[model samples]
Target: MYKQFLIIIIILVTTHKSVKGQDNQHPKWNTWATWGDQNNGTYRNPVLPADYSDLDCIRVGDDYYAISSTFQYSPGIIILHSKDLVNWTIKSHAVADITQISPEMNWDRMNRYGNGIWAGAIRYHKGKFWIYFGTPDEGYFMTTAKNIEGPWEPLHKIMGEAGWDDCSPFWDDDGQGYFVGTNFKDGYKIHLFKLAADGKDIIKGTDKVIYQSKGSEANKLYKINGTYYHFFSEVKADGRTVMMERSKNIWGPYTEFKQLSHAQNDMNSPNQGGIVQTQRGDWYFLTHHGDGDWFGRIMSLIPVNWVDGWPILGKVGEDGVGTMVWEGKKPVSGTKIITPQTSDSFLGTRLNEQWEWNYQPRADKWSLRERKGWLRLYAFGSLERNDNLTKVGNILTQRSMSTKANEVIVKLDLSGMADGQKAGFTHFGHPAYSAIGVHCDGKIKRLEYNLKGQVTEGDQINQNVVWLRSVWGFDGVSQYSYSTDGKNFKDFGPAYKLMWESYRGDRLGIYSYNNKQEKGYVDVDFFNYTFAGPQKTKK
Candidate 1:
């Protein structure tokens, strides 16, 4: 009896410890998501493990706002908000219509894949939020709003001169305004211009070349502690590195210059972003490494230390150059776990904050009021033969998370589909694309997979309600599946390797296009996303 009692007590103790151990594990904001602040008061680098490139961050009171470059996606200039620098969520966008720049996007069939709205800056001055960006083909533009989450003002073309990119705006304490930008056409030099009080017009004849370097861009200007600091990224022999030049006067014979951080550890080309200070006095550099893969330009937050009046990013070594930190103390003390927006239920009146179209969607082609709790995408006529996704407007898409494995499922209603129309889900990127959807032919609806313009037909579906799913593995391999009842999904096509193309990463898209005419449509009920992979822990 004594031996049996001891055995029972040991078993109970072991079970209790097991349960306690499981409970003690750090709670993750997202299990399958790649980058975010770990809930245990620590954060991993690539704080956001996605392609939020050309980043610029600012702190307003206790809140932080960071804006990223969206090449051709509208609404453009994605703005993310965070309470702590580690955890972030999508707040709003700066541009609403792509046609505001050119009608070619909507009418001329000119797909601006990797060109529109590249690398701008955001600033908060006086009582409003100002964002300035440039396009490779069209000049420079600016937009402002009273609220960060806003109805931003229309795009105002400030400069019509070609070949300017990566511009930043700064306002001095003396009520003077200055604009700095890189001129790729004019010997790749950095130029500074004096701006009027309204920040809409440049004071004439104030343009001066400040600095010249090979591939120098991503300009950010700051007046810190009675000194003017100009930060930008330049291509070095080893790789792209963050560079800084300082002066006592805003425009000048600026003297102090140095390379702050370079490709260190696994962070390749960690350059081109701004720095911000937390409420507790700690500073961090928000950057995107230029070593893009299937996922484009992932973002990281590097701790900064001010040594001799300069901000040193990441960790300083014996040589005094900083290396990227994969794990570090939380910049702010908070257990709140937040992440960027994903997954959407069409039940809402407005589209979810996560959704962005390839270009300005034809206002008359898409509607939410037609079917309550459903997103109805009308079949717009395609611009080319063979049904290319780039030529099709209203291709709703969102950024894919950087994880080992992610699955997206969409419930689509095909009752409204017309003949000669194809509507379904797509894993889209230029140079390579794959889609699985229902293709209507007269009265028959057939499931089909289009791989890089090669069409493969599948089993016919009789029902109006169908479910489609796409799964992505860590190795960048993707597979497609479909179901009629939502429970049993059968794999339908060969695995596809996702690739980076045209300056963008792989994006999951919901698309519809017609070869005959703009007649058919598809009703998307909801999009559900789930992830599974190794949990993040301190290394």
Candidate 2:
């Protein structure tokens, strides 16, 4: 009998330890879905399998840092850090508030849906980290910090003109700074410009168009072995392809070079990303599959082969340009498996690094302190002054991971919901944004799904607490369901198609807004997410 009692105690202790370990770690939503790290010294394409659109990577000693375009999301330009190139952690958002770039980016304006911060480049220059980007409508901007996990300086408008995109800054060996970008307003002309010594302004009278083509953009300039290599993307007769040019001089009469990558890619058109060389002197090209669907631009790490001074991305073919490669031995190893955190318990004073606001959020409308351990979003009218869910402010979200299948479950406390407050979970993307929400009207608490402004009401929800869910398939269709008891979920809306709108993928979001009055609020208890993961490929 004592032996049996001791065994029972051992079992209880073991179970308690397991639970305690989980409680100490950031909650993981999926048992498998999030991939890239194979845990076997190899990783698959897209070191990050999500909407890290128009990404750029650079190596600072042993550290690998990447930046992605956040578009209208506030605290813009997502920053990430990885010990090895395969796994990553969200460091922080580079831009604290994007309104400094343009008021249209303001939540009250809600005009720059897909227009803010386009393809940018992150470079550690002269002991400081510099980020430069262009908005299609707002010209060019730059931000800087001494540390990667920053307190970055407010964005400075480097160029005030418009219609340019995808910019990069390069510091020549002689200490002269140069900028390269596509002046899309000028028929996709890739221009080279001299930069001011401070790297905050584009020196006037130094702009020169070196190349022009349809959709010729995503420019990055590099000087290797005394030759300046210009890498950019062009929409070919086949599709968007990555091409190159080289010149002995930063300014040229440059030699038109070979294509670096083919249009046929596992990442659709594998173009638009930065190149990095490992500590071992090996090279890799981290590019995004530009021809992404609803998942936005998923990233891929392709091997870079240097032939006769030309950096070729991916596997080279008989035709000579590179093609997509899906798996590779990790560039750096012995690092722990790290994926961006997703599951939020709302236990911290600050929102998770994985979460970003739809736009410049109203500071007064959301709180982590209002409720001890919940995300509290206060009710307010759409900043754009309408009923569009896309226009509503203070919607906290994270990129929906790209996978065969993934889902999100969110628990919401609706007791504080005021009359006319719309609050709940959403799976919103670029044109086909939709949500499963709780609408509080008078004494009637109803359920509804908003699919691109078409609202369909479901069964009346009487509970002050509810759980909402959205499941997405490989085909980019999302079906939402909800449960009042947090256990049984019933399908609430039709399956909705998701599209990559404004160059971004669908995101899992929790929001609260009221078109009528701003008297109520909703507290998000937790967000549990999961996905079907990619199996590790044996090297």
Candidate 3:
């Protein structure tokens, strides 16, 4: 019978391409989930394999965006979006309350794990969309937004002056308004300030310090053509350097400086970031990699060369420094293969810009409309039963890509858990972490792991729907697994080892706590992230 009508037309065209690949309003383009598009248009370099550290980036017309450094998480500045600066996505988040600058980030958990919101700079100027960060314990902040995909405009401290750290903001060419920072407490010096053309205050005396070296700081201010440069990042001992300086005058003895990357061949210390250009003019240099490892400071795009007025970053040879570029070309030619912001399926209503909330979440205890599609979380426990996992406040994280192997899975429902609750799927970092749970106790549920800080106990999940998974390997090791019929999973406990605390790397949390009585809640419903071997067949 025509082979049974071509096997029912090949199972209805593979179930209509798997229901149009789950259609999350247009997702499909994982390309191994991290790293630039390698659909053969040739691209690679950290190009965003993960840990989008202190970079900056800006373009505005054909769109580019790029801002990073979320230090204590909570939403404080992430914004990505790209049309061709080598694919990117997560397009919004510029503060949604890190307790609006410390309420000890939520009633005294003080988990500013590595200090909040460090290195910043992202500008569009005049039509709005400027950013500017710093927080060696809350000092210089600033926000603005004529929309770079935001509602932004809350944080605006403008220098209460503490230790200051990598900051940048500039607008000149006659409209004059400037601010540049980095005063790691008086010696790592490199200050400049003078804004107030409505850039919001600080024209007091113009603060000047101009420049100082050795471990300089990630500064970044530019003018080009008429000079004024001043890009930075300098740890040097044969590593993180990528300095520069110039002056037709933006305040200085205005010297010349220039070091521009010598982190050479293996490209281990590329240093801070910022420097775009490409609408076919070609400039690039959006670095990171200051020797970070467990996956943290990743991002890199190098390849810039200006020479006479300085700008050199990677591959300039014959001793003018520069030399990174793992593989490139493709600055902006019909780009459209974006990637970055992995799987979720909590079926929308808000909460999947790749998630984030290790700190500022208590907003009525987390929900996505109470169980409609699932992502309820809600047990605010932990006043100390040995409160670890950094004092457990609403966990929920993401960013653990630099792939060579990955897996995330999550489907937990546990019938609104409770009796000293515990709901899980972790692999978070900071003195290490592990988890894989469901530990209720009064109606008896048990099936825990907890690992680093040991807890171990398993076999007692009479099912209410569970699925937790963790995987991850490429030497960062991680294991944990479970499944109550989400198709047989099993493994559990011990293998952990993924480290890199404070400045972060090794995330994938989604926890839910209750040291004893915050009443229960857990619902996740779906997360599913995947990535396979050989760096997904490299490019």
Among the numbered candidates, top TM-score falls to 1
TM-score of 3: 0.39
lDDT of 1: 0.83
Per-residue C-alpha lDDT of model 2 across residues 1-539, encoded as one tens digit per residue = 99999999999999999986653332122222335877788876666668888889999999999999989897899998888778888998889989988888887877887788889999999999999999888899999999988889988999988999999999998899999989888799888999999999999989999999999999999888888999998998988899999999889889758898888743477788989999999999887764546777777788899877888887787877887776678898887777788898989898889988888899998899988889888988985555578878888888887677788999998899988889888777655688899888898999988888788888898778898988887677788898978889899889887777767778888888988887898888889998766563345
lDDT of each: 0.83, 0.84, 0.77
TM-scores of the candidates in the order shown: 0.92, 0.91, 0.39
Task: Write the number of the candidate with greater TM-score, choosing between 1 and 2.
Answer: 1
Clashing pairs in 2: 29-529, 29-530, 30-530, 32-533, 33-531, 33-532, 33-533, 418-520, 430-501
On TM-score, the stronger of 2 and 3 is: 2
lDDT of 2 at 198: 92
* Candidate 2 regions with alpha-carbon error over 4 angstroms: 1-35, 265-267, 383-386, 536-539
Range of the 10 consecutive residues with the lowest summed lDDT in candidate 1: 24-33
In model 3, residue pairs whose N, Cα or C atoms come closer than 3 Å (at least 3 residues apart or on different chains), thus clashing, are 315-323
- Determine which window of 10 residues in candidate 3 has minimal summed lDDT: 23-32
Residue 210 accuracy (lDDT) in model 2:
92
